[model samples]
Target: MANMQWTLLLLIWMGQCCVIDCQLYEFHYINKEKTWTEAQQYCREKHTDLVTVTNMKDIKRLINISPGNWRGAWIGLYGQTDGTRKWHWSLPGVEFNESEKNWNTGEPNDKTGWQNCGIIWKNLKWGDLSCHDHQYFLCYDDKYILINKNKTWEDALIYCRDHHHDLVTITNMDQQRAVQQEAQFASTDYVWMGLSYACTLDLWFWVSDEVVRYKNWALDGPMDDCDMSGAMETKGNHQWCKKDDTEKFNFICST
Candidate 1:
């Protein structure tokens, strides 16, 4: 295993629960215009981070809130410093899929060579513009917050309860992907999740009081034992594994 950073301060990416029937984050339309950076600051201060739209449903919701000749609105998507023209969601752990793009015809031309920021056009497709340009933006309250600080599973639980809601609960695949995005940034090989074993009951259950119906166990079955909780790997496939509760690692929280 990689070495751990026990005392490092970590950033919490306010994430949204992207369940098909439920969402942990709520979106808001800022009618007032601001530069991309300014808008980002506003959102971080008042709400969660800027919105991280993972699928078509998010776009539809954005459109529903910002109707009428929408003009253009800033989104969380941005160009990386590498100039790969690689677009990344503002929230860490959220993914940007090339296949699911909603770009306008002949869009992202970057014709000016410096149109690095992203915006949603009136037609609901995406376009590129200068980051300095002023425009309205969208923000989500809270979803899946990744806490980078390393802590034991028990300590992590207390921290989450004091700061946000509870540790994350992955009851479905969508929630799995949602939490997996944040897991990718963990300083440790794996990040603590909310599931734990109950030796008396002889079963694993989510701390959020949900059943372990949506299983993503790394092995055929998780080890049923005492002093074990669940953690998700940071790399490939991001499957869940039973981890010792006394072990320290970063964690994700559901809000």
Candidate 2:
């Protein structure tokens, strides 16, 4: 019995150590000017991707990095011309699925032939639009918060990091259910989750770097793709579906 008690204490200590060692994401600013594509390449080769600014904190950090009334620099955001969009979280590691989608009528119609990004309407319906179009976006933090504003997956990631934490990461049924309850009060048809896809890795992971062990995919299964993120239906079994990361939606965050 004494030995078992010691083992339990050791395990608790190890868990605490892990928590202490977990570091929040960092940002690096490159003063050199470059196009979006060039900047992405530079960031990938040097740091991570061209600074995925997730929120006000990141924006401020970026400003502090230079500490000047500078104009602007290229970020990780860019569009694809190959007609194949690669879905990715503003935060890294999260994966996207193609099967889960909630598009509005005639969505992705490419009305102007340049519709390559995604957006969420006030009603929470998704639609494809031009990536060049400018709109307020969302970002994720490492903390938790329930934001009522609409934003794309990448934007949501930045927002959370700036305001509270990253988007909420649900690793268990209890967490999922709690988020589902939060969804009940959402004004939209669904709420954005911290879930996203990494096209390069071809896998899913939470922005918080948690393992993708527990899942709540819908009965129809999830769609796989490079341009989608995970979202929970406000009304159904709370099953997750795929959505274009560019699509805006209210999101939850956690620390």
**Residue-level lDDT tens digits of model 2 in 1-255:** 111100001011112335322323334434453444454555566544543433433355334444243334344433355557554433243233444444579875778987655544434345666655543232222223468999999998899889876787776654675477567667777788888888888888788787777899888766779988988888868788888888888888765
The runs of at least 3 residues in candidate 2 whose Cα sits more than 4 Å from the true structure, single-residue gaps closed, are 1-144
- The true-versus-predicted C-alpha distance at residue 145 of model 2, in Å, is 3.0
Q: Which candidate wins on lDDT?
A: 1
State TM-scores per candidate.
0.79, 0.45
**RMSD in angstroms, all models?**
9.0, 20.0
Judged by TM-score, which candidate is best? 1
Instruction: Supply the TM-score for candidate 2.
Output: 0.45
Query: What is residue 175's positional error in candidate 1, in angstroms?
Result: 1.2
Worst 10 residues of 2 by lDDT: 3-12
